[model samples]
Target: MSRRLVILRHARAEHGFAGPDHDRSLTESGRAQALEAGRRLALAGLVPDHVICSTATRTRQTLDGVLAELPARPSVEFEESAYAADLDTAFALINAADPDVGTLLLVGHNPTMADLASAFIDDPGLVSFPPASLAVVDLEVEWLYAAPGTGDGRILDGEGQVGKGEG
Candidate 1:
C-alpha cells in the first residue's frame, strides 16, 4: 500500500536555555511557525493518520501548535529517540509503524529530517528542510519496507518558513 510521510523540523527555538538541549522551548516566532505549518497542513488536506514526535520540548510544542490547527487528532507517540535521531533511527521508527496508517507525520530535529527527506526522493539537492519546514513525500512502498533510496516516491510539496511571512 502507498504511504505518505510528512517530515517536519521543529520550529525556531530559544538558543540560550540554561538546561539541557532537550529542554529548550520554541521561541515566539517558532510558535507562530508551528501554527502556520498546522494550518497549511489542514488547508492542504494532509492531516496525518499517525504522528511520531520527539520528546524534546521544542518538538512537543511544535506538535501541540500543529495539532491545534488539525481538524482531527491522530494517534501520537512522543519518543525520546527522536530527540536527536539520525537517519537510521528515523527509518526504524517509520518501519515500525502500523500498516493501517496511510499518512504519517514525523516531527523532530535536523539534519536527520533533511537526510531522511533526501533519501525518500531521487535528488538530495531538490529540497532543504529548514526550521519549521515541512516535506511531504509520497511513498510507493509500505511503511515496513521503507528505506533510503528504496521507496519510490517524490516530494509532493514543501513549505519553508511555513507560518512565518518569510516563505
Candidate 2:
C-alpha cells in the first residue's frame, strides 16, 4: 500500500528562554508559522491519520497549532526519543508507526527532520526543512519498511510552495 509521510520541523522558538533547551517555547512568529504550515498541508490534501511527535515544548506547541487548523484530530504519540534524534533513531521511531495508518506525521527537531526528509527523496539537496517547514513523501511500502531514498518527496514551506526531488 502507498503511504504518505509528513516530516515537519518545529517552528521558531525563543532563544533566550530561561529554561532547558527542550523546554523552550515557540515565539509569536513560530506560532504563526505553525498555523500556516497546517493550512499548507490541508491545501495539499496531506492531512495525517496519525502523528508521532517529539516530547519537547516547542514541538508540542507546533503540533497544537497545526492541529487547530485541521478538521479531524488523529491519534498522537509523544516520543521522547525524537527530541534530539539522529537519522537512524528517527527511522526507528517511524518504523514503529502503526501499520494501519495511511498517512503519518512526524513532528520534531532538526537537522534530524531535514535529514529524515532528505533520506527519503531522490535528491537530498532538494530538502530544506527550516523551522515550520515540512516534506510530504509518498512511499510504496508498509510503515515498517520505510528507508532512505525510497519515496518521492516534495518539500513544502508554510507558504505552500512545493519543492520536488529530481527523480
Candidate 3:
C-alpha cells in the first residue's frame, strides 16, 4: 500500500535575533506562514492521519500553529532525535511510524527535511523547500522500507507557494 507523507520545515523564527536555534520561536510571519501552509494542505486534502514533529521548539511551535487550524485534529508525536538530525536518523524514525496510518506528516528542521524530501520525491534540484515550506509526497510502498531514492514516490505538484509578507 502506498503511504503519503508531508514534510514541513519549521517557519521563520525570532528568538531575540541571537540565541540557540533549537529554542527559537516562530515570528509573527512565521506563525502566519504556518497557518497559510496548513490551509493550503487542508484545501488540497492533505491533512495527515498522524503528525510527527522534531522536538525542537521551532518545529513543535510550527506544528502547533498548523494544528490549531485543523478541523479534525490528528495524533501528534514528537521525536527529539530529529532536531538537527541527519538523513539516516530521519529514515529510522520514519520507518518506525505506525503502519496503520496511511498518511503521516513530519515537521522538522532543515538539511535533513530537504534532503529526505529530495530522496523520496526525485526532485532535489527543482524543489527547494524554504522555511515553512511543505512538500507532499506519495510513496507507492510501505513506510519502513522507504529510503533515499529507493521508493516510488512523486512530489504532488503546486504544493509550494510564496506567502504574503513572507519572511
Among these predicted structures, which one has the highest TM-score?
2
Better of 1 and 2 by TM-score: 2
Of 1 and 3, the candidate ahead on lDDT is 1
Clashes of each: 0, 0, 0
Each model's TM-score, in the order given? Answer: 0.88, 0.93, 0.86
- lDDT by residue (tens digit), candidate 2, 1-167: 67889999999999988879999999999999889888988877778999999999999999999999888889999999999899999989988988899999999998898888888766746645679978888887888989996777777754566667521
Model 3: how far residue 68 lies from native, Å: 1.9
RMSD (Cα, Å) for all candidates, in order, is 3.7, 2.1, 4.1
| lDDT by residue (tens digit), candidate 1, 1-167 | 66888888899999989999989999999999899889878877889999999999999999999999999999999998999789989999999999999999999998898788777656535556678877777777888888876654444334422221121
2 versus 3: better TM-score goes to: 2
Q: Model 3 — which ten-residue stretch has the worst lDDT?
A: 158-167
lDDT value for candidate 1? 0.83
Better of 1 and 2 by lDDT: 2
User: Where does candidate 1 stray beyond 4 Å?
Assistant: 152-167
* Candidate 1 local Cα displacement, residue 44, angstroms: 1.3
User: Which prediction has the highest lDDT against the true structure?
Assistant: 2
- The segments of candidate 2 whose C-alpha lies over 4 angstroms from its true place after superposition are 158-161, 165-167
Instruction: Report the backbone clash tally of model 1.
Output: 0
